[model samples]
Structure formats: structure tokens, C-alpha cells
Target: METNTEPQLPYMPGLAGVPAAESKVCDIDGQKGILFYRGYPIEELAEKSTFEETSYMLLYGQLPTKEQLDGFTHELVHHRRLKYKLIDLMKTLPETGHPMDALAAAVGALGMFYPHINVMDAAQRHGACVRLIAKLPTIVAAFHRMRRGDRDVLPNDKLNHAANFLYMLNEQEPDPFHAKILDTCLVLHAEHSMNASTFSARVTGSSLADSYAVVASAVGTLSGPLHGGANEDVLDMLQEIGTVENVIPWLDKAQAAKRKIPGFGHREYKVKDPRAKILQRLAEQLFARYGSTPLYDIAVKLESVMEERVGSKGIYPNVDFYSGLVYQKLGIPMDLFTPVFAIARVSGWLAHWMEQLENNRIFRPSQVYVGAPPRSYTSIDRR
Candidate 1:
């Protein structure tokens, strides 16, 4: 028998369960369905902290002092406005283009306008974080309006981050209740452990790319249907179900046909996603305030039926489940769902970028090539 001589390397498809890098930015207890950002439980932060404060914590690894938070928020508020040239550039994008593509394009172009090319400078990194977190909502809202031939609604200094975005998107001030709900949504989405987009940011940052490029790469990754568009899909799923009575039949048909029920399962969670619980409550609150809708009723029935069918298998509602209903109630357009996710996750991406820079090593993972080993090229049309 010929002796076999080949390296035996364990392969994990999609790099699953691989420890890509050490990160202090965020962690998940998948077994328990819990998430933490910089040592704070997500529940505590979502209940007690604002997006700005959560962003500060994720960036600096600690909650800010009162004075520190005030200063940070002031910087964010002041930097919210985009340069007119950037706005003019946004006007030139095809109005019907996906918002995520527009966002990625604008952000990549942003690299040309800002002086954040120096990735090693601490102050420059901080400025880049502030500018990105502040301006993303403005950029997203601007494109939303411009595409509709509506004039840009300037950011309101008096409003906090979430409310301001709502105001800019809709050209009217949002209710305080609605603003708080949106803020909690942002806090919940701001970070997750080693997610695809954060990993994209880290890998791009490993090349010492500037902040804009790093974020743009992550945005592009998130635009893919597999990663960031689940919420929108969930909304569509709800709309298709149409009524509480239709849910059981629809889910039965979907499961029998082996179609994935959007928002019903997560790779990371054996239990219901904690963020989904918060979002569900927010949805109920929204319904209570605005009165109920057919979609929410369908969502409720679907969750109950799904729990009965597969809950024992640890297949349950993830964050995307109820979040679509919440977003729809908040009046965000369906196409803007992922862009809003990008808005929240930018802080997390930057946090990962900074953490990647702290121990900068270019990511060059090896692969197991399994093609024909040594085949010589023959002359064309050789018999």
C-alpha cells in the first residue's frame, strides 16, 4: 500500500467556530441568548443607556462620565451636517438604487473628503468615529429625501440621535415615545460578537485601511441578503401571511416546502434573542399607542405556532422577527431597514476596527485546495 503523505488540517465551513481574533468589543452567550458590549449586559444598556452613550462605551470600553458624555454628544451633534458637495454627490446617484449601495458608495467617497487617512493617529481615529456615527443618519436620511424629490430636512440640535434621524427622514419631529423606542433599537443593534460585518471591518482594518474604507467594506458585506436584509424579509413575510388566520397555513406550507421562515432561527441563539424580546415589547407599545395592525397580529400567531412546532429544537424568534413590525410602525420605509441597521452597527464596526488596529496583523487564512494535484497543460485540441 502506498503511504499517504498529506497534511491533515481540520476544516470548518464558513469558518464556523473559528477564533478569528481576540475582541474586547462584544461577546455573546449563545447558549443563554445574551449579548454584552464592553462588559455591560445588553439588557441593562438597552433599558438604561442611549445609543450615544452605548457608542461611547463600545469605543472606549467604559461608560463615559457625565462631562465626557456631554462632550462626546456635542461633537456628534455638531458634526451631523454633511458638506454641501457631499450632498450634491448624493443627488447624482440613481434614485432607484438600493439604499445600502448608495450608502456604501457615499461612505467610500467620504474617504476622499476627510483627513482620516492617518490610521495610526489616535485623535484622527476618534474624529473618524465621531464623524461616522454622527453623519450616517444624516447621509441615510438625505438620500431618502433626495430620492423622493423632497428637500433635505436639516438635523435638529435639540433632538438626540434617534429622534433626529426620524426628524430628518420624515421632515417632522417624532414623538418622544417613538424616539425612545428607536434609540433602544439602535442600542440593541450597535454590537454583536464577531458578526460578518464586524469581521469584514476587522479584516479590512487589518490592511490598515482608513476608517471610511473599513466601514464601506463592512457596509457592502452587510448589503448581502444572507447577512443584513433579514428584517426586511421578515416584514415581507408578515405582509404575505396577511392575517392571523393565514399564519398557520402559510407556516405549514413554508416548512413543508423547506423554505426558511425569516426571523425564526438564529445561528447564535438556542433561546429567543434578547433583543427580539425588547423589540416585541416595543412593538406592543407602538401598537398600543397607534392602535393595532394586521401585521402584528400575524406576527404574534406565527411566533406562537413556530414555538409549538420547533421551539424544542431551539428554533425561536431572533431579533429580526419583531423588529420589522417595530420599524414599520416607526414609519421607516421597507428599503431603509438595512441602512438603519448599518447606522447602528457602524459604531460596532469602528470599535472592531480600532481593536483590530491595536494588534494589527493582516488576515491571511489558509485554505484546503482539493483539485487535481499536478496536471500539465496540453496543447489546445490535443487528442
Candidate 2:
């Protein structure tokens, strides 16, 4: 079939080979190597706003006043407890199930329990957002405890989001320094215009499904190594390399064999990912406050080598590089790294769902189908 050669839409700047996700909000100036969230620079928000505050700002277009933030915090803490039905469902999962898999299943089950979650109603949507933000820690902690045959740790309402999550996970209230690190890490991971997971959410919501349904699908996407689990893999990569001395040969050999670094090369920002810088600072703080760990040394050495090796090719760390170190240092098992990402990202995922519903258009992008010409079916006996 002959087809018109002229492009229907304006030629898009990036192709599928690149790592760009097309969400209306955030943009990265790869040439200048700058990153912005809802048009606000990451550094500005990182400096001025708390994780909770930034999350609220991203969800609502405007930043919340003090009283509104207080109310949101109160609401989040008040609902931190799991619903009885949800707890019962969690009890049924095999203890061997991966925490990420378990959380995805539990969150999806929540949608069935409250199937009427209105994708359009701001209040109802915020209710879902609050539930996800509050309860993810509880679910994650419970899964961890269950796997290890330990008792569940309940949430403490008096603490902040970062402290409360750490408290629940560790069964002890974390000190200010540790909580602060977690707060910054969560803020860094909060939103990106639309990644594979966020786009998965939007695409699912385009079908007009409830927010939970879309988020559940997105969680599955985030569970993948290429998307969110790269943090865990980076830790694994470092562990396998074992020392600063090993960094060079491992990287050179991987490069020689044509392997892309797990934590390098973003599709949107050709220069570097802004979130990587934020996480790198947190990792540095953790390393500086506490005496050195071999993993930290390995990462630093790898960074220097990789920068010299791949700087011209635009291969650099994304959000995953240092996140594993934080979790590992926090005494969190390596298995739960991506689940932590999901916990923080639930806020952004719901924010996008709300955005999608506001002037609702189904997310149906046309495919450029390239295929064989129409032909008749062959006869059954034609050998």
C-alpha cells in the first residue's frame, strides 16, 4: 500500500531510542544539563521545601500554605493504619513473596475494595493519594517482618513522614540526621514528568480506570530493573566489583563488550540526570557523617572512571546510583529498594492521575504501523 510521506504531527524532538517520557509538566535542558519540576528547578525546591511540602506542591499546582500543609500532614498520619481487610489480604501472601510484588498486589486489592475511586473528584483523588502515601510504609514494613518471621511494626502519628517511615521499618525512631537524609531522598524521587511507570499510569487512566488501577500497573513497571530496580542492581554491581581497584576493569570490560551501565545514560537529559546530583549529595552526607564503607569508596571510584570513560557519550548516573547505599546503610535489606521508590512515587502517580482527569482525554497515541501488504490466506495443503 502506498502511503503519504509527509509527517502528520510535527517531528518530535526525541525518538523511542532515547529515554524521554512525554508528560506535560517537567522538562530537562540536556544541553545546559538542567532539570525542572513543574517548571520549578530541583535545587530551589530541594533547598526551600520539605518532602511533604514539595509533594503537596507537585500534586496541587500551587504550594500549600502552612495551615494546609498541617492539615495534610494530620490527615496522612491519621490514616496510616491499614484497613482490616487490607491487613487480612497481606496475611495471605506467601512469606516468600517479594515485597514489591506483595505491595503491588495489596494496592491493587485496595482498588477492588474501593472500586468507585473517582479519577476526577479532587477530594476523592486526594483521599487515595493520602492512603497510598501513608500506608505504603506500613505495607512494606509488614512484608519485611513477615518474611523474617518478626512482628509487625505500627506507624507512629507523632513523627514526620520520613521519620515515621523509618520508625515503622526499623522499629525505632530514627535520629534527625537519618530522617533528614530520607526526606531529601523521597523528595528527589517524588516526580518526573512521565516515566515508563508514570506513562503506564496515564495510559491506563486514559482507559478511564480508577487511579488505583493505573497506579497498580505503574508499580509493576517500576518493579522492573530498567526503570526503578536499577538501584538494587547498582548495589549488586558494586558488591560484585568488591573494591575501588576493581571498578576500572569491570567498567572497561563492560564497555568493551558494549554493555550500558545500569545507572547511566538518561534519555531526557543528555548531560546528566538532576536527581542523581541530589541523591549523590545525600550519599555523601551519609558517608561523611558515618565513617567510610567499602561500597561508598567503590561508587566514588566507579564515578570517576565512568565520567572519564563515558562523559562525551552522555552516560552518567540517574536516580538509582546512590539510593541503594542509603537503604543499605539504613539497615534496610536490598530487596526493598524499589518498594521505597514506589512509596515516594505514589504521590506523583496520583498527581498525574488527577491531572489526566481534569480535562479528560483518553491517552490513545496513534501507532505508525509498518507491516506487510494485504494478502490472501494460503491454502491448507500448499506445502
Candidate 3:
């Protein structure tokens, strides 16, 4: 690695305890269970704004006026198609593959095609952001079809980002209510300060990697359970319980061992995760719309158990806790849950990647050596 700076400083604060150096986009008041993006509360934005508007605010650091948001939305709609080169590359990957894997590969391929793949120019970086925000959903949805022996779904110029995505998945236009729910899901997922995937993106950006490469790295990290798959695990846990009567007992056993109930607690939020509250409300609305399903009832029971069994101050649901039930209530497929997470979180990832690039710093975090001193090299004959 090239360096003008040498003899790097060490920082070995305990994992899950180290304060992040600084962040420009989000503030996590973990004690209060509050999350704000660019100084705006998630609840206020979720209530009054569209996902597109919120995504804009996160990326650009100010909420757009009606016209500004419209123009931004218009440009996204216009650039929905992937470069032909990218689509062809997608055809080469195995058809029976995870959608996130396919997304990672496709994102990496951008680095191959770019003449300035590692360039950090401002205009080039901005263009990269636009392409990613526009193309990611289509890439994810196309991979969904590929896994099922279907052809790549063409992007729709008419519908907005999230609706067009759902339309591609099912080969039909989304109903207004469902589209709204999905859009809200996108807004909720868009940014969460410095979550796993966003940090990966920022780390890559800090290393001077291209945005696509940064995003590809994010796709890899997001495929993990402890980070992005909480909602899916939430469903799996509910399935294991299967009835309202089972919730309390399940919580009692899990809490007795201090086993995490996937969505029940957060590293930051000692209280209720606000995103969970919003999603829980959405879950209720969907329950009212379509009538209660077993999953919804199970989720409610689990929520009650967490707050009752564990002290409310100690354990409350996080975003991942309620999102799966919301998706279940909306009739979305279970396997699509985490990809849905990616689709929403892409906005925040892009925003942070761009932000990190603007004032680049390689994230070479130091490790504290705690090893045996003066180890001797062993020869093969010594055995």
C-alpha cells in the first residue's frame, strides 16, 4: 500500500463499545431509541414524506422542496436501465444463485468496465451514485427471476423506484396501497447511520474504491444474519413459536439464557427502536386491511412478551423485528425479505459512500497485539 503517513496510530477499544470516530449523516441516541438522519427525526419524515424525498434528504443533507424532489425523481425514472454491458455480464453468472450474490457480482463488474474505475472525481462520483440508486433494485429483481428460470425483467419507466421493482418481480403493476407500504419500507430501510453495509461502503470509499465496488462490498456484508437478515430471522422465530400461548414461554426460555431474540434488542437503542414503532403501526394497518394472519398475531404476541418478560427498558423491538411481519402482512414472499432490506438500504449506502469519498481517509483501524511473546519457529523435523 502507498503511504505518505507512516507509524499509524492504534485504537483498540472493545468491540460493541468503541465510539465511532464521527458521523455526518446520522445520530443514534441509543439510550432513547431515537434515530435521526441529517438532523431530522425518522418519525416525522416517515409520517409526512415519501421515501424518495427522505432518500434525497439523506443523500443531499437537506429535504428537497416539491420541485427539487420532483426533478430528482424524474432523473431516477429516466435512468432506470442498466448499461447494456452490465446486463450481459449478469447473464454469465449461475442462474440458481442468491440475489444478493448476483448483486455483488454485478456491482463488481462496474469496476471492470470503467476506464477510471478507481477515480475519485466529484462529478464521476455523483454519476456513480445516480446509477447505483437507479439500477440496484432492477439488478436485485432480475436476479430473483434468474433464480426461478425467468428472463431478466425489464425496468418500467412509468412507476417510481420501489413500485417498478415490485412490478418487475410479479410481472404486474403494484396496487396503490401495497406500493405505498413498500415505499415506506424503503424509507425506513434507507439509512441507519453506520450500520454494517453502510460502514462497508464507507470503508471501501475510504480506501479509494469505486462506488460500485463499495456497494459490492456492502452486498457481501449485508448477506450476513447478525446485520441485515434480522427481519427474516424474526419470521423464523415466530414460526418456531406458532401460537400466542407460546410467546411468553419462548421469551422466558430465551431470556433466561440471554439469547437474543433477533429483533428484540439493539446495540444502540436501550429503549424502543423508533423504526420498529413505525413498522409495528404499519403491521397493524395491514392487519386491519387484510385481516389477521398467524404471523401478525405471532408478532404481536412476541412484542408483548418482550416488553413484559424482559424489562421494557432492557429489550424492545428493533427495525428488523417488525419489518418481516409488515412484509408478511403485505403478502410478500419470505425469501425476498432481506433483498427488500438491500433495496431500501442502498440509498443510505450510496449517501455514505459518497460522503466518505468527499473527504477520503483509508480506514486502517489498528489492532492491539495480545499474543505470546518471543515465539520460536518450529522446524518440520521437530514434530
Candidate 4:
């Protein structure tokens, strides 16, 4: 008999409240419904900063000076175009495939082009960061247009990051109001403290994998319904409710049936998610700009009803709750909701990816075995 020598440690289901790595990238105070990136409040960043600048802060760990911002923005703008081969690759994917699937594959392939990516080289790391944050939106928008049998639009250098993405997706410049709202959405979503996808990114990056592989893994994690896909589900839920009047009855039925409602609860946030509050405001502003949709009305009613019923339970509307309403009003297709989330989140993933490399350690968490104990093997003919 072999003697057991491994240390016994308590097993936590899903690694809840486990600290995996130290990071200075982002922080969340779920109790207070506050989020900060590099010590700056998310609300301030969303209101006063551009996605480009916010992305810069997340990656570099500080606000950029005007000159620094210009250089960084220049790099992002210049790197926005994907190689033609990548576009051709997207053409081969089935139109029915999920956007996230296509995005993951394309990003993985994108890494293949940079086969010599040296994580140890600071210059190379900076290039990789710039290229990824620059190109993700182009990848998402290009595939979207291609799947619809429309020609892909080239990056418009004249536009800012958020506006340029909206331009590529729609083949026309978006209204300033729409672009500003979307920029705020991106800032809100750019980073969250150690989320599921960010954890996946860190895990993969800890293996010293290339940036693309790290991000691709994170994209795959985000595709799950409980994570980035919740915004899409929120839209589906809103459509199913059909009208504002149906909100309370639907909640009553869903609650009584014990069916989980999408977009209402967050694991990190005990109070109403701060991002959800901002997004709700953006939804209202968007409604005012483009005329209201039935979905927003229903969402409003649903929030009120949910508050009356479940607010005391620390289950409240999270970021996903109102984001879909805002995106829908912007004319983004429901399925692309998660892909857009990926575009914004790539910054956070890359930031964490770089941080993981700084103090790289392969994750090797111990798991308690709960299966049958070792049994002696018998010869085939003998029981």
C-alpha cells in the first residue's frame, strides 16, 4: 500500500472567495456597488474618459497624459485593420456558428501569425497589447457583416474607438449621442475585478501562453450563459415579456416556478450593480434619442417588480440587465451582444495577461477525490 503524503486542504466549490493571484488592475466593492480601475472610480472613467483612455489606464496602471494618450490612441487606430487572410478565414466558418465561437477561433489563428511572441520583451508585450485591443472590434464587426453577406467595412481612422466600431458594424457613422453612450458602456465593461473570464485569462496566461491564446480562452469562458451571454438572455427575456404590463405577471410566474431570471443577480454584487444603474440611464437617454422601445419599458417595470420582491435578498439587477436594452436601441443584433462584450473585455484580459506573466506560476490547485478507491485489476477471464 502507498502512503498518502499530500497535504489536506479544504475544497471550495467553484473556488469561491479564493485568491488566485495578486493584481493592481481592478477592484470591486460589491457591498457598496462600486468598481475601480487602478484606483479610479468606474463612474468617473465612464463619464469623463474615452474607451481608448480607459483601456490605456487598465493596461498601463495609470491615467495617460495628453501626449501619452495621443501616442497610444495613434497606435490603436493604426493597428485596427486585420490582415486579409483573417477575413478570408472568417468566410469559411458556418454562418450559423455562434459569434463567440468564430471569435475564439479567429483570435487563436491570429496568434499563429505571431509565432515568435516573446512575453519577456517589453516592446513585444506592448505591441501585443495594442494590437489586440485595436483589432478585436474589427474582428467582431467584420464577421458580423460577412455573415450577413455584406462586404466588410474598413476601419475608419477618423473615428474614435467606440465610434469607429459602430461605424464598421453599421457601414455608416453613428450619431454622436449613440457613440457616446456606447463609449460609456465600453468603459463600464472594460474591466471588472477577477471575473470568471478574467480568471480564465489569468489561468491560461500563467502557462506562458501567447496573448491571443489567453484572450481566446477568456472569450470561450465569457460565452457561457452565466457570464457574457447574460446580456443576450436579457434581451430574450424582455421580448418574451412582450409589454410593460406583462412584467409583474411574468416575474410572479417565473419566481413561483423557481426559474432563474437572467440579468438580475450577480455573484460579486450584493446591491444593484453600479454598471446596471449607469446602463439604465444610458437606455433612457437612448430611448429619448431614438424613440422608446417596448423592451425598455418592460425592463423598467421588471426592475421595479424585482426590487419589491427580491431586493432584500441581495439579488438585484446586475450590469447585464440594462446593457442589452441599450445595445438593442443601438441596432446591434441580439446574438452579437456577447461579442461586443468580448470587444470591451479584451482590454481587461490583456491587462491581466501581462500581469500574469510578471509573476508567472502555473495554477495547480488540488482537488479532493470523491470517486471509488483503488481496486485490484483482475485478468480478463477471471472476475
Candidate 5:
């Protein structure tokens, strides 16, 4: 037998622009700043859909009917309670631990409690998906309260998903306007096709890993600053700018030093991100209700300065730009920003995991070997 010895193809750094899989889950037209899920425009979904409804659409591939949604919501609400052992495990984590770390650990622990599900079975997968969607916010809220030495605020079944999370975190019922804002945020963050974390989920699922393990891999991936953590960086940058007047000078210095502006650019959208557009409008409404924060003013000015400097180069405000500011106004701490992203994005992660199982193939791309090849073996003292 003879092996083919053809030269390897040129390497593409980061596998940019590669088509790893075919998905009906979501689509993005980067140039036009358009995003869609199941062939429906993002704008329409953000305007009309609740996070629960959007989560259903992502997981099941269609918007649920009123009856279906009611049943699904009931299931989610009931499953919000975590096993006591999971809460005990979260307590052992250092208070300084990042929320994403606690979340990944807790999600991985879920497999131990719910061990009977068969990953290959569709019904079992759906059950796991619902549990994860229901429980993540509760886990996040538990860790948040424990870290602050506050008494744990259990989930409120009477409220919707977004509102319940706020109630648990704040230990007070969320105002209707605040709850609605957070719900829209969740809908916007629910899914994006083949993003870093979603790709991580699919890769783990391709190995036939269980749903908990698949989501754990994604949580770890999302912990990276370049992914889900970018919003935290954006908020920090806005605070450092300090005032609207500092925006122009700060942009100049940052550009001169070749420093990156956290939220001013995105790899996918050449124009403003569609989610950012929606969030910007939400920010306006929030400021009107809660009174404007200084950070929001700085963020707006920063965007204007960034546009003048780099707008022609296809750099613009991304989802992270306004999302952090919105979360700040909602009384969320900066560190918890990425964990909130995880809560919303778990729907998408599970969707990709299920999709990967439907057409399972192990991802094994070859690498171009540039190091010494076919070297002769040498004895230790040969030289």
C-alpha cells in the first residue's frame, strides 16, 4: 500500500471563513448587518418574542403555539430549583472565583444527579435541554448571592424566566419595565450561528459527550475574554474614559498606542451589530425610566468618536458596546456580565449540540506540519 504524499494546503489562521457545518439554526449577512433565526429576521424576533419563546424556537426549530408555549413555560418554571448538593458544591468555590467557573462546575455536576438520560434519544435530549435552560439562571443567581454573603434568593415561579432571575439576584420583585428590558436582552443573546462557544458545544457533542459535558465545554470557552467576557472589558473601558469630553482624546491615544477598543469592532458585522441596534434603543428607554448613568453617556460619546476614527474601515459598535451599559443600568455587577451571557446563550449551545448529534461527525481537521519531519532516531550519547 502507498500513502498519498501530496503537500499540505496552506494554513488558515483561526480557520477563519471556514464552513464547518450546515445549519438551519441561524444566519448572518455580515455586510448588511442582518441576522435571522429559522428564516425570520432578528429585528422582528427582538421586537415580538420573549426569551422563553425564542429559546423554544431555537431548540425545537419553530415558534411554539400558545398552548405549547404555556406548557413549556410551566416545565421551565418548575425545574428552576437545583438539587441541594449542587448548591453545596457552589458554596465550596472561592468567593473570588469567576461566575463562569462556578457555572461550568455546577452544570457538569448536574450530570451526576440526572444520570439516566440517553444522549442518543431525542426525548431525553429535549428533557436535558429544558433542565439546563431552566436551571442556569438559578445557578448563576445562587453563586452571585453566596459570593456577596447574601442569603440565597430562591427562584420565584410566579415570574417569567428573565424576571425570576432578577428577583433572585436582587431579592426583590423586578419592575415591569426592567423585566421587559432584560427579556429583550435575553432574546437578542439567545443564538448566533457557529460562534466560538456554539462551535465548542458542537465539537463536544460530536464526540457523543453527554449534554452536561457539552454545555460545560461551552461555558469554559465562553469564559475567554474574546468571547462572552468582552462586555466586561467594554464596561471597564467606558469607566476608564470617565466622561464624554474624554472620548476624543482617549480614542486618539488608544489608536496611537495601537490599543484595542473593546466594543468598537466585531469580526462578523461590518456595520453596527443588529443586536446592538436593538440594545441601543433599549438603553434609551431604560435611561428614561431609571435616569441616565454616566457610563451610558460615555458609551454614546465613545461610539461617535470611534465612528469618526474607524467607521470607514468597517469598525462599529458591536453587541458588547451597549449590552454592558444596559446591564449596568439594570443593577447587575460588571463581573456577572458574562455569566448572564451564558444564561441566555445556553439555549443556542444546546441547540447546536442537538444539531451535531442529528448529523454526527467528529471534527478532525489536519494540520500543516512545518517542523522537522522524518528525523532519524538518535541514541542519547550519539552526539
Candidate 6:
């Protein structure tokens, strides 16, 4: 036999373009800049559906009827209150910790309060899903308050999901306009097919971990700058630019140094991200109500400059670009941005978790060996 040597296939860094699993939960058409959940267009969902309705659709795979939505809304509202022990746990967390860090820790601790259930039981999984969704906003709001030496505000069941979160965080009821804006933001952020955090969620859930642990893993993933933290960076960039005149100089320096302009590009979007478009409209509407700030003008000019320079390369403003401005106008603290992302994304995370459990498999991908050939071990004292 003749020994033949041939080059092996190149490894895809970061598993780019790899299809790890099948999902009916979300569909993304990157070329068209379209996103859907269970065959419903995201634009339609964001415009017509409330976050509660969207969450139910993502979780149960269809738009709920009036009766079903009523029950689902009731369950979500009823479970919004955190256990007293959980609040005490939040109190003990260092006030200096980032909200994302505090959120992941709090969610992980939820596994302790609500013990693991039968992974295969549909009802038990649904219950866990509801608890995680309901309690996440409370956890986020409590951490926000606790970090600032403010008293924790309890959840008000009378308010809708988005309104209740704002109430808890601000310790006062939000105006209806502000509440609707937050609700739309939540719907926009609810799901994206196989993003970094969602992948972390499904991978963790594949090991038969409880839903809390799975979501905790995702929260950790989203805490990274490359993901959920991008919104904060976008805001920081706009603040640094300060004025419309500074936008051109900043872009020139950034381009010369090859530094990324945060919020200008996304891997999955060739056109402007649909979510970004919606957020842009929301930001404008917010500016109309609250009056456009200097930073919003800077953002608009920066977006125009980026579009002129890089739009042909499939680079455009993403969901992060305008979302931070909207949140800032809504009076959300800068640090809590990612925590709010987690609050919205938990629905998608739970959906992926349940789907992973439905078709169980351990996620153990093989890596190409790129090390020394097999050799005998040497003694510790020997070289």
C-alpha cells in the first residue's frame, strides 16, 4: 500500500457557518435582514404584540388566544415577587459589582430556591420557564436599587410586564408612553436565532441542567463586551463624540487606527438590522416626547457617516446602535442595559432550553489535535 498525504479541511474559527442543531424557534435571513419567531415576522410581532404575547409565542410556538394569554399573563404577574431570601442574597452582594455579574449570580442562586425538576416533564419545565421570566425583571430591578443604596421596590401585579419592571426600578409608575416603548424594546430583543448567549443556553441545557442554570450560563455569555455590552459601548462612543462636528474626526481617527466603531457592524446582518430599524423609530418617538438630546444628534450623524463609508460592505447600525439612547431616555442606568437584555432574552433562552431537552444530546465537539505527538510522561524532577 502506498502512503498518501493530503491536506485536511480548514477549521472554521468560531464555528462560523456551522449548523449545530435544528430549531423551529427562530429563523434569520441575514441577506434580507429579516428575523422571525415560529414563522411570525419580527416586525409584525414588535408592532402588534406585547412582550407577554411575544414571550408566550416564543415559549409555546403560536400566538395565544385571549383565554390563553390571560392565563399566561396572570402566571407571569403572580410569579414576579421574589422570595425574601433571594432579596437578602441580593443585599449581601457587593454594591460595586456589575449588574450583569450580580444578575448571573442571582439567577444561579434561583436553582437553589427552586430545586431541579424532572427534565422530561413538560409541565415542570413550563413552570421553571415562567418563574425565570417573571423573576428576572425583579432580580434586575432589585439589584439596581440595592447597588445604589435605595430600597428594593416590590413588584406590582397590576402593571403589565414592561410597566412593572419600570415601576420596580424607578419606584414609581411609568407613563403609558414610556411603558409602551419599553414593551416594544423587549419584543425586539426577545430572540435572535443562535446568537452567542442562546448557544450557551442550549449547550448548557443539553447536559440536563435545570432551566435556571442554563439561563445563568447565557447571562454570563451575554455579559461579554462583544455581545450585550455593545449597547453600553455605543452610548459611550456617542458621548465621546459629543457634537456632530466631532463625528468626522472620530471616524477618521478610528479608521486610521483600525478600531471598530461600536454598533456599526453585525455578523448576521447584510442590510440594516430590522431590530435596529424599529429601535431607530422608537428612539425618534422618544426624542419627540422628551426632546432630542445632543447625544442623539451625534448618533444620527455618526450613523450617516458610517453608512456612507461602509454600507456597501454590508456594515450598518445594529440593534445596539439606537437601543442605548432609547434606554437612556427611559432613565435606565447605563450598567443595567445588559441586565435588561437578559430580562428580554430569557424567554428565548428558556425556549431553547426546553427544545434541547426535548431532543437530548450531550454537546461534546471534537477539536483537531494541534499539540506534540504522544510521548511518555517525564518525572516531575526531570527536565
How big is the positional error of residue 306 in model 6, measured in Å on the Cα after superposition?
Answer: 1.0
Better of 2 and 5 by lDDT: 5
- Model 6, residue pairs in steric clash: none
User: Please, what are the lDDT tens digits per residue for candidate 1 over residues 1-383?
Assistant: 33346775798998988899998988888789888898899999989999999999999999999999999999999999998999999999999999999999989988889954689889999999999999999999999999999988899999999999999999899999999999999999999978899899999999989999999999999999999989999988998888888888898899899999999888899999999999999999999989988888888889899999999999999999988889988899989999999999999999999998997999999877777666668988994
TM-score of 3: 0.91
Show the lowest summed lDDT stretch of 10 residues, model 4: 1-10
lDDT, candidate 5, 1-383, per-residue tens:
44448888778888888888999899999999999988889899989999999999999899999999999999999899999888888999999998999999999999999997788998899899999999999999999999999867888999999999999999999998899999999989989998899989998989888999999999999999888877888888988989889888888899899998998787789999999999999999999977988888888888887788789999999999899889988999888999999999999999888888887889988987666656677998996
lDDT of 2 by residue, 256-284 (tens): 89976777778777666777887878777
lDDT-sorted candidate list, best first: 1, 6, 5, 4, 2, 3
Question: Candidates' TM-scores?
Answer: 0.97, 0.91, 0.91, 0.98, 0.97, 0.97
Worst 10 residues of 3 by lDDT: 1-10
lDDT of candidate 4 vs native? Answer: 0.90
Which residues of candidate 2, in runs, are more than 4 Å off? 1-24, 370-372, 377-383
Candidate 2 backbone overlaps, count: 1
lDDT of 4 by residue, 1-383 (tens): 56466887889888899898899998889999999899999888888999999998989898999999999999999999999989999999998899999999999999987778998788999999999899999999999998999999999999999999999999999999889999999998899978899999999988888888999999999999778788888888999999988888888899889999999888889999999988988888888877998888788889888888899999999999899889988889989899999999999999998888887888888778878777888999997
Worst 10 residues of 5 by lDDT: 1-10
**After superposing candidate 1, which stretches have Cα over 4 Å from the reference?**
1-8, 381-383
Model 3 stretches astray by more than 4 angstroms: 1-14, 115-119, 256-258, 375-383
Candidate 6, 170-265: lDDT as tens digits: 889999999999999999999998999999999999999888899999999999988888899998998888889999998999999999999988
Error of 3 at 127 (Å): 0.9
Residue 67 accuracy (lDDT) in model 4: 100
Clashing residue pairs in candidate 1 are none
RMSD of 6: 2.3
